[model samples]
Target: MKISIFAGVLLISAALIFLGPDTADATSFDTRHVNMGMKADQCTAVMNEGIRRLNQANTFCKSTNTFLTGDNAYHTGTICRSGERGKVWPQNHNLRISLDIYPLVECNLKNKGAKYPDCDYTGVAYTNRTIIVSCTSDKGGGVPFHIEGNLVKYK
Candidate 1:
C-alpha cells in the first residue's frame, strides 16, 4: 500500500509538470475599440488602433494612410516593420490593412450583386483582420466595426 501511494504521487507530479500551460501560446494582445459617430470618427478609430498595435509590437514601424474614394468606402494602408530591438516583437514583414466600410453609397440593394438590404448593411468590418501573436512568430491583430443607423460601433 505504501509503495502504491508513492508511485501515484510521483505520477501525478510528473503529469502536472509535463502538462503545464505552454508559455509560447499565451502572449496575444487585444486591439482597442472605438465607436464614436460619423464616418470620420469610425475611420480614425480604426487607423489609430492599428498604429497603436504596431507601436506596441515594435519600436520601429512605418504607417501610411490613403483615402481611396469620396466617402469612407475603401481605404488601404500599410505598416512596414523594420529594425527591431527589446521586448517588442512584431512579424518581420509588412502589415497591410485593407479597410472597406461598406454601405457607403456604393453598396445598396440594387448595387449589382447586393445580398443584404441597404439600411440593414451591418456586420463586423474587421473580422478577417485579426491579430494573433506570441513572443515569436505568432503575433498580429484585427479590428471589427458595426454600423447602426448613422452611428458606428466597434467590436
Candidate 2:
C-alpha cells in the first residue's frame, strides 16, 4: 500500500510539471515583423505601425473597442527565449539583435466622462529606453520576433 501511494504521488507531480501554464502563446508571436539587417529607423517604423493599429482600436481613443489591461500605447518588449523558458539560443553570425528607445503611452477612460469611451489621456507617458528585438533568418531576410524588456535607466 505504501509503495502504491508513493508511485501515485510521483505520477501526479510529473503530470503537473508537464502541464503547467506556458508564458508564451500564439498571440505573443503575432507581433509585427522587421527585416534582419534593417536600420534602427526602419525597425522603429514597423513597430510604430503596430502601435498605431492598436491605438486605432482602442475605445479610449474614441474607437469602438476597449483596450485590454496591460496593453501599452506603443510596442513594448516581450519575453523572448529560443526554446522553453530560460534557455538561451546559441549565438550565430546571422542572428541580429537591436535595442532602441521609443515613446510609450497609457490611456484610460475618465470616471467623470459625460459619455462612455471618453478619452481621458491621464495614464503614464514615458520613453521606453530598453526595447530589445531579435531578428532571425526567414524566407528572404531576417524577421524580428523576440522582444525583451529591460530595467528603465533614468539619465
Candidate 3:
C-alpha cells in the first residue's frame, strides 16, 4: 500500500510538470487588426514621434503577450511583395524609422499572433503621447505599415 501511494504521487507530479502552464513560451494573445485609413505621410509622422518619445522618456513599452490587459505597442516595417499587393505608396527617408522602433515592438515567437489595434482618429491612447497609427498604401490591398508608441507619466 505504501509503495503504491508513492508511485501514484510520483506520476501525478510528473504529469503536472510536463502539462502545466509553460510561462517561458513567447505567445501573443487576443490579436486584432483595424483599418486606419492612413497615408504614407501620416505613417512617417508616427514613426518620427515614436522615436522621439523613446528618446525623451529613456524607457519603452511594448504590446504585452498577456490577453486583454490593454497595454499596447506598435510594430513598424515595410512590406514589399510582388504579384499580390496589400498597400502601395511612395517610399522616403522617414520609412527608415521602422528600424528604430523594432526593438520596442518585437513579438515573441511563442506569442506568435500578437497585434495592436489602430489608434483613434485623434491618435491618442491611454495618454496623448501614446498613439497607434497605420499608413495604408494609396493602392488597394497593400499591407498597411504601423507605428505605435507612448509617453506616459507614472504616478
Candidate 4:
C-alpha cells in the first residue's frame, strides 16, 4: 500500500507540474492581431527592434501576445515554414511589458530609428501591452510577409 501510494503521488505530481503552469498562463490571457493602439512612429520603432533581433539570429520570430506583466522578453522561432503560416507564435511571455499607468498614446519608444512603413507592424493591448512582428526577404528585398498572432489558452 505504501509503495502504491507513493507511485500514484508521483504520477499526480508529474501531471500537475506539466498542467499547472500552462493552466495558469492560459487563464491569465488576452490577445488580438489588428490592434490600432500604436501610431505610425511607434510601429516603426518596434519593427526596427524586430529586424535587429532577427538579423543577429537570422531567423523568423514572433512576439508574445501577452503584454506588460514584467520587464518582458521576446523569443526567436525557426525559419517560419509554410506550415507555421498564419499562426500566433508566443515568442515570449508578456515579452509581458505594460506601461499600465497611462493611455499608452505616445508609443513609448525612447531611442529608435526614424519611422517607415515599408514592412512591419506594431500594436498595443488594451492594457498597454505592445508587440511587434515583421520580416523581409534576403535577395529580393520585396518579398511579401505577414505576421502571425498566436493566441492560446490553457486547458
Candidate 5:
C-alpha cells in the first residue's frame, strides 16, 4: 500500500514538472485568435484590421473629449493581452510556434489636425514587418495565443 501511494505521487509530480500548468488561461492572450498554418497574407490582413480598430478607438476617444491610457486604449480596441502579449520568446516553452505572420503591420497613433484637440484625428500607414507568436491547441489544431515579439529584421 505504501509503495503504491508513493508511486502515484511520484507520477503526478513528474507529469506536472514536464507539462507545466494548464494552458486554458493562456487563451486570454490570444489577441488575434489566429490559428497555426495561416498564410502570410491572411495574417497581415488580420493584423492590419486590428491596428485599424485600435486607431478607431483612439479617434473615438478624441472625438468624445476623452483620453485613454495605454491599457484602456488596448482594451477599447479588443486587443487586450492580459500578461503574455509582448514577452520575449522563451526557449524552453512547450507551446507550438508559427512564424507564418511575416511582413506584419506595426501601427502607431499620430496626432493630426491643428484644431481637433490632441489626438482627435489619427492616420495609419501600412508597412511590412515580422512578428513571432506562440500557439496552443485546444479545439483541434493550434491557435496562436501570444505575440512573442515583433521582429524588425530577420533572415
Candidate 6:
C-alpha cells in the first residue's frame, strides 16, 4: 500500500515538473512539460494526470487571456501507473497533461519527491498549430491551427 502511494506520486510528478513559459516566436518555439521515467509502471498514471493538468492549465490560460486561439490538443487515455499496478494497487486518476504555446505549468507536490513539496519542472515541448501548412498555402486557405506534442507514456 505504501509503495503504491509513493509510486503514484512519482508518476504524476514527472509530467507536472515540466511546465515552463511559452517561447514560440518566428525564430524558434519553446515549450515544456514533464517526462516520466520509462522504466517505471507509473507512466500510465502520469499520462492520465498530464491530461487533467493540461485541462486545468488551459482553463487558467483562458481566464488570463494568454492565447487568442486557446489551448489545443489534450492527453488522451493517459494512465500514468504507480509502481503498484493491477488489482493490488491501481492509480485513481493517472497524470496526463497537454502541451500548449500559452504555457503556465502548475506543478504538483508529488514531483518534489519525498523532499521538496514545492518543486516543479519545465520540459521542452514541440507542437504545430497549423495542420494544413503546405496545403493551406497552396489552396490559399491559410494554415489551419493545430496542437500536437508529447503523448503520455503507457505500458
Q: Which portions of model 6 show Cα errors greater than 4 Å?
A: 1-40, 56-155
Compose the digit string of candidate 2's lDDT tens values, residues 114-141: 2323333334344543333343332223
Model 2, stretches more than 4 Å misplaced?
Answer: 1-79, 82-100, 112-115, 131-151
Which ranges of candidate 3 are over 4 A from the true structure? 20-59, 63-155
C-alpha TM-scores of all predictions: 0.24, 0.24, 0.21, 0.25, 0.29, 0.18
Worst 10 residues of 3 by lDDT: 22-31
Ranking by TM-score: 5, 4, 1, 2, 3, 6
Cα lDDT tens digits, model 4, 103-138, are: 222222333333322334454443332332232322
**Candidate 5 lDDT, tens digit per residue, 1-155?**
99999999999999877655324434445344323333333433443355476564333222111111121222211112223332224572433333222323232234433222233223222223234445453322333455554444444
Judged by lDDT relative to the true structure, which candidate is superior, 2 or 3?
2
- Look at candidate 5 and tell me the lDDT of residue 109: 31
Q: What is the C-alpha RMSD of each candidate to the true structure, in Å?
A: 17.0, 14.1, 17.2, 14.7, 13.1, 21.7
For 1-155, candidate 3 gives per-residue lDDT tens digits of: 99999999999999888643321211111122221333322432443344354463333323321111122322322322222321222363222121121112212222223222222111222222222223333332223244332233233
148: Cα error in model 6, Å? 8.9
Q: How does residue 141 of candidate 3 score in lDDT? A: 22
lDDT of 1 by residue, 108-149 (tens): 121233221211222223322322112222233221121111
lDDT string, candidate 6, 1-155, tens digits: 99999999997886555421111211121112223222223333443354455564322111100111224322211111122111111131212122223222222333433222122332322233211011112222221122222233332
Candidate 5 residue 39 C-alpha distance from true site, Å? 16
Clashing pairs counted in every model:
9, 0, 11, 6, 1, 33
Error of 4 at 23 (Å): 0.8
TM-score of 6: 0.18
Best by lDDT: 5
Model 4 clash number: 6
Query: What's model 2's TM-score?
Result: 0.24
